[model samples]
Target: MTPYDAPLPQAPAAPALIDGFGRQVTYLRVSVTDRCDLRCVYCMAEHMTFLPKREVLTLEELDRIASAFVTLGVRKLRITGGEPLVRKGVMGLFENLSRHLRSGALDELTLTTNGTRLAEFAADLARLGVRRVNVSLDTLKPDLFRQLTRGGDLAKVIAGIDAAQGAGLSVKINAVALKDDNAAELPDLIAWAHGRGLEATLIEAMPLGEIEYDRTDQFLSLKAVRSHLESFWTLTETDHRTGGPARYVRVEETGGRLGFITPLTHNFCEACNRVRLTCTGTLHSCLGRDDASDLRAVIRAGADDAALKNAIRRAVDAKPKGHDFQIARAAAPAVSRHMSTTGG
Candidate 1:
């Protein structure tokens, strides 16, 4: 067939899916790789073993899976990773998927990165249709940054944020507020992000897996953090709400916005509309719970699109109402896989 004479291909059929809470899951968080440059204390401890390279999904495989999800009513896609930028050919993957984004095949294309390598890839990512970026930067002080990240360069993260903004991508700075460490820097971080036209988000420290200290000590609630910040900035409530976890508010007079994710104090599970796809190809219905359904095995077994969609539907039907960290702690002490592995 001649180039212009070939018939157009038929669009893929949509799949039936349901979330753990029985909600129609329409969002997908895909972890491209389990390898990250920084070893954030909460995500992974020092001296952790990286996933085998062979076990990681290839770019083509990732695109195929994402395409299938998009066909199955996945309107939004977030590229996550141990750090997604660390993966090779990620730009190419975005480029390949961009073609299928017409007709609202994807409503939002976003990414959550540690911001270590974003400086180098921001421009490329912007050109590839990435609309927003959430960078995990907890502290501004170089010493504390190094201490928290365990040998990571804070300058690189700062540069990445700047680069992302320069590339025209909407930026949100994610800060995990600890009790003593960098908790006091909230005002400065807010001022800095506002000055740069970026949103600053303060996230409560979650007890995911094995870490260095007690969960209680590291657990800084949103109320405590907001109490400290309310003294400095005239915090005005915002009606704006995104599908993600953060509760957003605007800073009066500064033209900057702040967000708080209080998973412990104020859980937003009822409005939770997210589902995570792990790097190993398992579909996790909830981040707090360890329950997951294996999609990789089904794909590898030569399952057709109908079979694959059935697997996705079954996975969502198995989604939990919410995580039971409290009960898990009281009971058998359920330890979760690291956040990076879970694509948080």
Candidate 2:
């Protein structure tokens, strides 16, 4: 076994993780690869050059880093990417995680995908011990789907969602509220997801990275989304909170639950309990800030498990009190890294 495959060090007390802000950091988001099948308007530019295979983290490196966090009390791990499923041998990664990480140490091992490949991997994912899956789908209309995702098949995504449910996996739909795009479809989208027992999450578009569209013009506040949905439905607060920052509600009439992730209208940093490890192995303290620790370099330098764990602790200690996205302008020099590079 390599240094990364070494066993954990001596265990700490019950509370193993504490950030600089005195918050319990228990969730970790890891991006597997910086390659995607579809290029959406808000997520990435059209002509993006994908990362070389040599630059991204290997399965062993991911296991080592993730196991370090787990030993430190990170109970929930979400595998994300430009599109996680597009990466080959993803099921093998899930197998390693299931064998080592999720067999009781982790509370949940989930994934966030663009929903294009769910049909091909859903059954295997459920069999491999995934807790749940969140599929990013902005619109239901075929033409609008193609326009937004730059040539994605709406039927395939819908089929993928159905495939996940058919495999008995809990699914949630993630939709970003773009002002002139799918903002008006919130009620219908939530209703549609509810019809199939999936929660529809309306996310506020954060001004991050270089985009093909005018991000500011497309930015729809959660306040505006609430008002729009209230005109057509009665939404009462629900207690279905999770590790993420999405605030939730239930439809009074249809019993459909809706979620709002408002990085723009209402900041949820106080309850933020997670950290992101980009595909390039940069441990980002905050999504809105580019400050990161190069864990990959440390690991490749032959650090043992103890040293690796120390690096993780040091990175956690660097966690900021909050993000600057709340006051960030669209054109400002904040969060220049695209979502593809960073993960969900």
Candidate 3:
């Protein structure tokens, strides 16, 4: 057949409906497992109960649910976990999801890992069409890293970063700035990532788990962090990209990008356009809030595709305009579960 006689490809379908908050609900964060290798003080304690493997979503179930969400309006998918790479058959799951993108049913697919297991799977993950990765690394110091992660090996995580970079995937380093801990290492972390040609992001410490520290004392706002860096480097705002939380800016002398996720100081709830699915099949509308809908029970009850879709739509509709932690604390505030179980 001649080139002119080729048939036109079909266009991908749009989402079913937009919510009242003006969010298209196009992005989905799927938590594959709640089990993680490290025990960060903010995320979880050294000893904690993990979800039973049986309770977590199966690969088939996750694929089916993700496919349904794509049909509804989820064009982007991010596979997260306590540490997704720790879960088995993750490569197979990525392989299955890749088909949807090829068929124009899914637009973009990404993953968030702790980088402990990324060194082993980086090449395979890239080969499977996962071009984006977010690695959680709080401190560049080996001693501090060990102290923060309880018993994690900082060397392994560094190797993982190198492997990911070698795989030719766009990697973003996620750092949770906690006062009195690794907050002082922010400039060093940014400089290190910039030296290696990778984007570095610093996030404010969020109060979620049953921790003892006061939020006022622990929370290091992005504005303050930026101001601290201004003495060492000048920053200029860069274009905001789609499907992620970070507000980008370029370092003047270094010629590298740095990102800040100021969730606590400046809430981005008004422009929130995402939903989270816990490893146990619960749909969390807001990360800071405990409002969730149990999708596992409904799915197990033989809810059809339409029923599941409507349930997700309802959950999205119920998304709070903004989190009330500040206002709630002024009244009778309550804390939610740890960030590890909540998925960072």
The list of candidate 2 runs beyond 4 A from truth reads 1-15, 100-102, 326-330
Q: Which ten-residue region of model 2 has the weakest summed lDDT?
A: 325-334
lDDT string for model 1 (200-276, tens) is: 89987776767665657666778987887778778899987656878888899689889999877886777777789
Task: Tell me the lDDT of candidate 2.
Answer: 0.86
Candidate closer to the true structure by TM-score (higher is better), 1 or 2: 2
Q: Residue 329, candidate 1: how far off, in angstroms? A: 8.8
Q: What lDDT is reached at residue 60 by model 2? A: 82
lDDT of 2 by residue, 1-344 (tens): 99999998965554567888888899999999888899888888999988888899998888889888887889888999989999888888888887644457888888999998999999999998885899999998999999999999999898899899999899999999888988878778888899888888889887678766667778888897798778878889989987899989998877777889887678788877999998888999788888899999999999998898888888888898878774344466368889889998
- TM-score rank order: 2, 3, 1
| Lowest summed lDDT window (length 10), candidate 3 | 326-335
Residue 255 in candidate 1 has what lDDT?
91
Pairs of residues at least 3 apart in sequence or in different chains that clash in candidate 3: 15-73
TM-score of each: 0.92, 0.94, 0.92
Candidate no. 2 TM-score: 0.94
Off by over 4 Å in 3: 1-15, 212-216, 326-335
User: Candidate 1: which stretches are off by over 4 Å?
Assistant: 1-16, 20-22, 327-334
**RMSD each, Å:** 3.2, 4.5, 3.2
